[model samples]
Target chain A: MLRYTEDHEWLRAEGEEVVVGITAHAAEQLGDVVFIELPEVGREVTKGEEIVVIESVKAASEITAPLAGTITAVNDAVEADPGSVNSDAAAAWFFRIKPTEPDLTGFMDEAAYQAMIG
Target chain B: MADTPGGLRRTPLHDLHLARGARMVPFAGWEMPVQYPMGVLGEHNHTRAKAGLFDVSHMGQIVLRPAVEWPSGHARPAAHEEVNDLKLRLETLVAADVLGIPQGRQRYGLFTTPEGGVLDDLMIADKGDHLLLVVNAANVEADLAHLRTLEGTDVVLLDARSLMALQGPEAEAVLERLVPGVAAMRFMDVAEFDWDGARLWVSRSGYTGEDGFEISIPDHRAVEFAEALLGDEAVALIGLGARDSLRLEAGMPLYGNDMDAGTTPGSAGLGWSIPKVRRTGGARAGGFPGAERILAELAEGAKATRRGLRPEGRAPIREGVPLYEAETGGEPIGTVRSGGFGPTVGGPIATATLPAHLPEGATVWAELRGKRIPATIVPLPFIKPSYKR
Candidate 1:
């Protein structure tokens, strides 16, 4: 199951962990992604806390956590090639987080996320 | 975002910009385009390679006329005495030697405050009968107020005029199609011409380090002129985003960002604009505002001087980033005033204020988002200017 946050982050449940990345809408708005600073693995994050910093040629943006969790792993590939986020935002997962709260409340579904962006 | 105080003013080409899919943003009380569909990097590179058209009507254009009436009324021959008197009177407000500029020529000048800080940087064109001054949009009001304080000069704001800049190596060729004799005009030369029954005040000068022309036309004919220029295959409509990056790469300092009212001409590395005629030893010396402090600073170097910085990595370091000594491991010694990813350089570059004692090629570290990135101070401009003599 996939869930979206108002801040344009997406999370997908992968058994015991969840994958996180920014939405295509957010990536398109950010223009070209030149650099990204991802949180280190094992860092404790609360809901709506800033975890990633993405920079384009023009400006910078911060991505917040959608749920309380501990960062399990990060995508080294995206850090190596930040442009991949603009190429395919959905597939370019930023990190894997093990949710502290199993019940992911306050997240929107696919339709809700689409409507929110619109 | 909510509307700012006083609302945003649209330029004469606002409709055309929207039609061309420009991303409009608030800039200095104007709704200006930040970038077009081509994006900042593409637009920047295109201007450097070919020609780029920019709508800079947001800038303030004013004409200063002498209060004195012509002696022979209708048939005046050159009126050299009146022009000379007017130039001398105008020189009281600026640091540049305005009286020395010949007819049909323009020079870069600065309006310095009483404390030696720069109020605004402007271009003054000696138009024989009157002087045409082009100032930054943000400083227009203050500049006008300052100019109004003069006793014998009549300052008239050219609000109905639209200013456009066509810049690049091929700018001359592209502009020659519309104005036949524009190619002959040297850098900083201003001329009045007729284009399709409309009058134009064109100058062979621009903010970009490239050879270009700044065309001032009636507001009603702006869209027509812009469309005609865009009709050329070599000319593309560029936005403020590319303009900023291009000027930064050219080592041009912005008024409010790079050098504000707190920064003096000596510290901003713009002492060249203060000609020798205005110095202490010259004939007409120490007459302009802050002349004493400015001349002193010129002889004895300022505490901080503006320098070009080249960061080591690809991650761009933006403005307000602190600068630290390379090996001292102490507090910040300076701050980045203007910085961005230079599309032409293909990496991050900046202009910062560092100790005047720091020589070129000195190593410094810029603190971006908490990490100290090593950068080297180099001689400006990062790219050589291609102005036609």
Candidate 2:
């Protein structure tokens, strides 16, 4: 199952962990991504904390944690090639977090995400 | 987003920009296009390779002439004697050598405050009949009021015209197709041309550091003119975002960001625009505002000077980020004035006002998102300017 946040982040459940990345709508709005800095793998992050710093050609944006979790792993591929996120935002997961709360009711589903973007 | 403080003013090409899928943003109280669907990076790279059309109509355009009376029901160009009178009067407010500029030419200049700081930066063009001044959009009212303070000069704002810049190497070929004789012009040369019976003022200059022309067209015919230019395969409508990157890559200083009322000409690295005639030990010197401090700084040196910086990583150290000499706690050495990714240079670049005493190749640490990022001081013009000289 997939979950979306109003801030344009997406979460996917994979076994005991959940992967987080930005939506296609967010990537399109960010223009061309040139550089990115991902949080460390062992960093403990709280909800609404800025974890990822993304720089496009014209401006900069920060991606925040949607829920309290410990960063299990960060995507090295996206950091190596920042343009990959623009190419396929859905597949380019930013990080994998072990959430303290397993409940996913707070996040918007696919239809809700589409309606929010609209 | 909602337009604040009443509403935002739109240029003549507002609807045209919407048709081209532009993202409009508020800039200097105007609803200007920040980017197109192609994105700022693409537009920036495209301009470096080919041609890009820009709408700069929000900038202020004004004409200054000698306050002379003419015969009833008729007006005439400023005579040779009156021309000298007009030039000398203008020298009181600006830093450039107004009396030295030849007719049909222009020079980048600055308006200085009475306290030795820069008030605004502008371009002064010699138009024979009158001197033409192009200033920043935010300073329109202030510039008009300042120019009106001149005792023997008449200030008139040219609000009915639209300003467009056709930039890059392919700009000549694209523009020469619609208007002839622009090929003969060189950098900073100003000329008047007629387009379809309408008076077109043409200047062989632009902020992009490319060989281009800034053409002033009437509002009624601006859309037709823009469409005609866009019809060419090489011409694409560029927005302010790419314009910022291009100008920064060219090492150009933005008025509000890099320099302001609190920043002096010496600290702003604008000594090139201050001619010798206005300096000490020269003929006709020391009459303009802030002449004492400006001349002293020119003779000696300013405490602070503008310097180019290359950030450690690809991430840009944006404007207003504090800079420190040490990695940890210490007073900020400087603040980034303007900075972003340099698409042409393939890295991040910035410009800042640093201590003049700092040695060459000194490294200053910029605090980015609470992390210390080291940036090296370097020379300017990260990319060489390609002006047609």
Candidate 3:
């Protein structure tokens, strides 16, 4: 399942952790994702809060966390090659975090993500 | 490309951009198509290898008449040409000779306040009888207001046009076929001609370092002109995305990013723009903002200056990031101005300001999120300038 924000961030869950990245529409709009600053592994982030900064050729964007959690693992590859997000946003997760309070029942699913993008 | 400004603004070719499947975004209060379906990389490469048609109508395109005074004796709104030309003699705008700027030639100029502080930087094209000015979209209203106050001669300001940019290696060939005789115009020259039954002022100039032209046409005819240009096989509609990357590769500075009111021409590495005449004029140099400080800086030399930065790896060091000394990583020496992944350069590049004495190979630090990233000082225009002689 994938949940998206009106601002174009996307969130998904993997077991106890949630994976987050910008949606394809957002990545495309950002042009080239040249640099991405991921949050530290132990940083506590709240839902709908800015935790990452993604810079493109034209401007810098703050990527908001779709859910509250403690960051666990960051995709160093995406930081090393931010263009991966441009090529495949869904697969180029910025980080994986375990929610401080997990309850996936309230989040939007894949259909909602598609509708939000549309 | 479909991002309409809702209540902001829609360029003359707004519909055309959306129709072509452009990914539009709000920029400087206007709905601008930043790129088409071809994406940023494709559009960037296309403009480098071929011709890229850019709908730059969001930029304010104004025409100037010589200045005129009312019966009350108060000067009318300054025509763009008159203010620049008249002020040039007085050195009121900047320490540059506007009148000497050849007809059809494009020159980068700045508006300096009495204190010698920068008001704005713009591209001014002298068109013999009149002047054509292209100002930043965000500052159009303010620029117009400022120009009004400086109109001492017979002149009028007209905002009845939109502009487009056709840039890249094959740009000249495509433009030549569309508008003959443009081929003879040297880089920085301006010429008037017809395109699709409408008259236009074409300048052999653009932000990108390429053989290109910036065409000014009636607002109503912009869509038609855009369509006609796009009809060519070699022309692809590029948006702001590619425009940014292209300029980055060329090492050109964006007004608000690499420069602002606080930064002086000397510190920004724009001393070349200040003519030699102004330098020798000494006491006669017209007073602009921070005149005492800027002129002093010019005479004494800038403390710190803008330079290009190359990060060691693919990770980019962005703006607002601080730079450190090479040997000991002592005090913060400078800050990143414009940093990004330049698709044309195939690497990460940045424009930063640092101590003027810092050697080319000097190392620096860019605070990316909290981690200090290592960066090296390098010469600008990450790629070579390819302007037509």
Best by the DockQ measure: 2
Could you give the C-alpha RMSD of every candidate to the true structure, in order shown?
2.7, 2.0, 4.7
Model 2 has a DockQ score of 0.82
Give the DockQ ranking, best first: 2, 1, 3
* lDDT (tens digit, per residue) of candidate 2 on A51-102: 9999987689999998888999999999988888888999999999988886
TM-score of chain B of 2: 0.97
Docking quality class, candidate 1: medium
| Top-lDDT structure, candidate number | 2
How far out, in Å, is residue B256 in model 1? 0.7
lDDT, residue B286, model 1: 69
Question: Which residue segments of model 2 deviate by more than 4 Å?
Answer: B1-6, B71-74
Of candidates 2 and 1, the better by lDDT? 2
TM-score of chain B of 3: 0.90
State the local distance difference test value for candidate 1. Answer: 0.89
Candidate 3 CAPRI assessment class: acceptable
Question: In model 1, which runs have C-alpha deviations exceeding 4 angstroms?
Answer: A102-105, B1-6, B70-78, B326-329
Higher-scoring candidate on TM-score, 1 or 2: 2
